[model samples]
Target: MQLPVEIPGLLNYWIVIVLMMVGFFVVISHGNLVKKIVGLNVFQVSVFVLYITMSKIDGGAAPILDDAIKNYSNPLPHVLILTAIVVGVATTALGLALIVRIRDAYGTIEDDEITNQERDDA
Candidate 1:
């Protein structure tokens, strides 16, 4: 049950996964709120890229229910990804707004400093 070109496909998937993991790790490991936001954006964009890549066939055209084009792809994935992208934008916006609040409240944008400030205040 061996495939002739397993390495190529696996290599692509591996790169995608590695990029995703790296983005997430950067988001979590960053202490600056803005950096975290950038990381999250990277993470989200990576997922979007992966999704769009997966949605494409060897030579499939855009999915439109029209009589002119018969080799159309399934539009569900693209639609779902559009929704996900909207949600991700909203999430990123919320996170940035929270960062603004955090900056105003703590006078700093570093996560550790904010936590320390809160502790000192308490």
Candidate 2:
């Protein structure tokens, strides 16, 4: 049922856009690698929300092969989302591990300090 002058139930995308912007800001504005990974996580979470939202068919049934309604979201998007989630987790883990290693190597987690130390060491 479309409204006379406005679209019905269109409040989800704003959240995604906000999350996307926040993630982008965090990733770009922050100097710490850990903070960067945190931002990346927020960014990935927004993508996950976008994917799940795409999978939800309005007034549609699940993807079960039943004998009733025949509408369901395509499985490929969902599968891809699942795989993406796994990849995001792996990436975060690897990034965090690298940050820990960097902290150990430079004795500081601050990006400026690390760069300055590297210059001094060289």
Q: Which candidate is the best by lDDT?
A: 2
Cα lDDT of model 1 by residue, 1-122, tens digit: 23455445445566778778888998889999899888888788777767766776644677767887667666777888899999998999999999889878789999898889889889
lDDT of 2 by residue, 31-73 (tens): 8889989999999998988887777666656688888857876
Candidates' TM-scores? 0.79, 0.84
RMSD of 2: 4.0
Model 1 lDDT at residue 66: 83
Worst 10 residues of 1 by lDDT: 1-10
Report residue 16 deviation for candidate 1 (angstroms): 2.3
Question: Please, what is the whole-model Cα lDDT of each candidate in the order they appear?
Answer: 0.80, 0.83
